[model samples]
Target chain A: MQFNANTKMAEVIHVNYLLLPILNRFDIQLGFGDKTISEICAEQKINVDFFLEIINSFHDYNYFPQDRLQSFPLDLIIEYILKSHYYYINIKVPLIETTIITLSTSSDKLQNKYVQLIVKFFQEYKEELINHITDEEIRVYPYMLSVDKALRSGNIGKELVEKVKKNPIRIIESEHTNIEDKLFDLKNIIIKYLPPATNYSLSNTLLIELFRLEQDLNDHARIEDKVLVPKVEMLENQILQKL
Target chain B: MNLKKTIICVKSPIIYRGIAYCIHSIQPGIELEHYNNIDKLLKDDNHEDKLFILDINLLPDPAFYFLERMFVNFQDLTLIALSERFLSDKLAVYFRGSILITDSEEIVKNKLKNIIDTGKEINRTNRKNSAISEREQEVLRLVAFGFTNKQISDQLYISTHTVITHRKNISSKLGIKTIAGLTVYAIINGIISPDEML
Candidate 1:
């Protein structure tokens, strides 16, 4: 179901409880009783259209409208992305890691060893994820923001030009591959390899969290690749052409 | 007999669980792996003696090629097409049998039981090629240990080309392509100990 500005805020969560985190990233909280999405967005000073797009994209995987998302100001999308990165690093990663740690401690000796291996594998993935996020935060996002500023103010400064020429957003477009592959492997290891003696409930929880994170990251990557990069590339071209 | 495991690749969680519940009820000790997609199931599984319950609608574009790949690559697999409605005879030819989502629980159990028993009987008579050879197992062991084909060939005193062919047959027979997957399979099956991995 597609959510719109007129849709009640509480009903969205009723449809999919998984969307609660996405709503939280938007600074939306519970007790939005009988309030329409636009009403809550207006109160929080959030862009209603952008909020709807984000919620709809998360709610329905196939509902991402690339053109509509690209039409938003680059900083707006970047701000949302920054919030997502925060959610991933500070929230999702910790939750999954802690769960794995707890699962390892609670299992039998043999299962515990495998869980430890998984913990190590997950640590590697987490490191790679953090590195990727750090690159985007320190290098890529700042570069895109500067380009956004140049495009907005029509002032292509020397530093901004050098930055654009030095680090094109296209370079890291395929960087999501390794992280994605590692996540796939992690899931497969749990699904097919974990022995029958392991804790089913805990394994189920880990699988759920991993699958959620995978979906969230995939959607986030699609936005970055399909929308953010192309928009920034356009801004870069405009700035260079004027120069 | 490779009937100890089953892989269900269906989109609907309810149907997947329902079928799994029936299978477990019928054969409590069976190893069941559930997947929502066909490609992941095919790639990660050890297809030897494993029954695949595939959602017909979830097949990739050019589904015939995928079905053909299963027929050619994995001779030991018993595929059961799953759908909410009846399938045409042409498409139905791809499956050893078809399970309708609308089948009652008892009906489903009987169907699964028949498949499991018949699968074992069929494999016992003429399935020598379906089993992994000793040389192939040695190659798989080294492969899981992160050895290259040349290294495995050298250790086993086989030609590199023979090692490659063995690896191909191992992958085709087992449906496990990644080193990590094979390693996990080796550990689980006791071909390689978890300590060896360390």
Candidate 2:
């Protein structure tokens, strides 16, 4: 089922504006406000359906009217994005960058070529990718963390948690489609590092090294996409109830 | 079918629960007891005459301790393996005369019955082969196939002294005095083929 943050039709009475600034500062310090998404969800006994719905809601920019943020728990949603989405990318992308650097400087020519291709791929997609990361960190994660803190301290009240519950995490997941497409494009380009038959010793050595680097990157990306991101989002929601 | 009491000794609660569910569903009139710690289960005198279901994932050290103790203490108890997916491949060479391997509870129940029935049949077929443990059978198979103590140790990844100990146990159990006698007995009991012996 899709999560709808606005479904509860809670009256859009303006709360204190100071709360936003306080939550934003809190989110940055707590690494998306403490507990990880997976741990929170697991602790809260939140179902997979609810988790997916919440994710989808965050990424569904077109369907979710921009003005709706005033009505929705904007701070909490931002925290979710920061911890669940941006945090994983933040941790993984640098590792991938380092791997690319290592592969490029390898003495083997084949390895260098493969690394060069990866570097080029990242360079080409840099704007779109960086923007995605920045948007999550700046906008989505902080919001989610605020909601988490509200839920945990019993300060926000159950009405807010129920409203947040209605909003599916799936919205953000839908936006991941674009992100995944770019990642796949990079992966496809990187796959060319496989060992190719060559009489030249230098080319053959480079190819083997390149193949290994590609494998490492692929594994790194898979862990980020499959495990880390979802877990982080879950944590943000859980922290809402606790903090 | 007579109601047989089965005891499952596995480390993982998920697997243990899954097996318990399957065994309860498939086998009627069978009592299934689950234990995470084999040592605790073994210490209980109530374990007598019950089918012992072991997971190979539970083995190689701490689990091996239980297996060795069981061989010494509970000779009549039939021990069957609820194996990990990879264990079937790893243990295939030794499985011929040693452990009966299965992944599911229903299959384990059926295999346990077969082992019990086969135990009875072996007793009827020849009294001389009645006392061999699964490990002894494994050592016997390796020995019959012409593996020296060191070779057997290397193949099984055990010490040569351990291989020698297994060999000694095989001789004592089967009433065979020499390696040649052990080889002849292993061949007659289908532990190893003549070609394998060469």
Candidate 3:
């Protein structure tokens, strides 16, 4: 879809379903009717550039440039990425875990162990995800911020620049694969091994949650792996060249 | 004054005459070559800075294709699209820095004057060689498909940091900043097709 100032909010959603959660973060209600994206954002006082860049990136990442991205606050991208992380950690994971817990309490001895296994698998996945995000939030994101700061000033210390340039982007990369393995394993376990007789409805619900998480987790990993890692590497390289 | 490096493609004799007249009036000593067919104009590749003006209303498809092909292969050229009415809705998304002008000679003269006055050719040479890298193009292809940075990294087997570096460099080189803008550029530059975009 060719998004412009006059593009309707409803039209964008119609084009890309993935953009729904992105809009929801900005308090953009679905009942916006035929209002143009620019108009709705104006009323809401949202940064239209930031909103457009995020949606467009979600719709298609190739459209954005560094300077254009620089026009909007980098904090917004960081914030958006962080929010996605929060959604997975606080909301999506817990919802799935809660369903697993409910399944455990149901009056079926045979399914109880299976339910416990699923719940335990999810907890492990959650721990890994939390640890990965926390690492990014604590170590990597701050480094990016400092890079942004140095970029703006046009002067960076040799050691500081080299530190970022050499920052362990590779270290965090393996974690994504590990997470993918666990998610994939848990999904296969549920589909192939879980006995669905007693907790048929519950298992179905669990299956649905798992499927959704699987998709969401893929997107999450993509954001981290494709988007975040590349950005930092770029910043690091820029600093290195300057040094 | 020397019309050694410009190509104008317009099928209409009357419109072509008007443009010629306008160019002569703007700079009386200036020289020009006109072609009724876009194919003839693109027949030879010039290494010097060149300006190409296409009448969008006449054979619009080939005109756009010609422009994009020139952009990808030829390197240093300024492209102009002249139409009787605004055809931006259908064509603007594919505009890769091409100046869009209506069929008014006065408007064309004004726009062309700006290009000439700024000495546009001198700068284009510097930009031609700094084309987006192969890796950046790969990042661009995935980005157009809406893969988040991390997803792109996983698929390409590159670190997310490397993907970002490519993206930043891609944006800077293309002079486009939004994902949608980059998407349009990819299509225009033949990096990706319109059908490929979702």
For each candidate, the alpha-carbon lDDT, in order, equals: 0.77, 0.49, 0.64
lDDT for model 2 comes to 0.49
**What are the root-mean-square deviations of the candidates from the true structure over C-alphas?**
17.7, 25.3, 24.9
Q: Per-prediction interface RMSD?
A: 3.0, 29.9, 19.7
DockQ of candidate model 3: 0.01
TM-score of 1: 0.63
- After superposition, the stretches of candidate 3 with alpha carbons farther than 4 Å from their true spots are A1-5, A11-18, A47-53, A56-73, A168-177, B1-198
Model 2 per-residue lDDT tens digits across residues B11-41: 8887777766656665665787787865655
Worst 10 residues of 2 chain B by lDDT: B89-98
Q: What is the TM-score of each candidate against the true structure?
A: 0.63, 0.25, 0.48
C-alpha DockQ for predicted model 1: 0.14
Best by DockQ: 1
| Predicted candidate 3 versus true structure: per-residue lDDT over B1-198, tens digit per residue | 134455667887877777777666766755577888767756757635565677766554555565456668765555556655434333432332233333244445644554454344224333243356545655786787788999888766679998898898886666555564465455434455444443
In CAPRI terms, model 1 is classed as: incorrect
The numbered model that scores best in lDDT is: 1
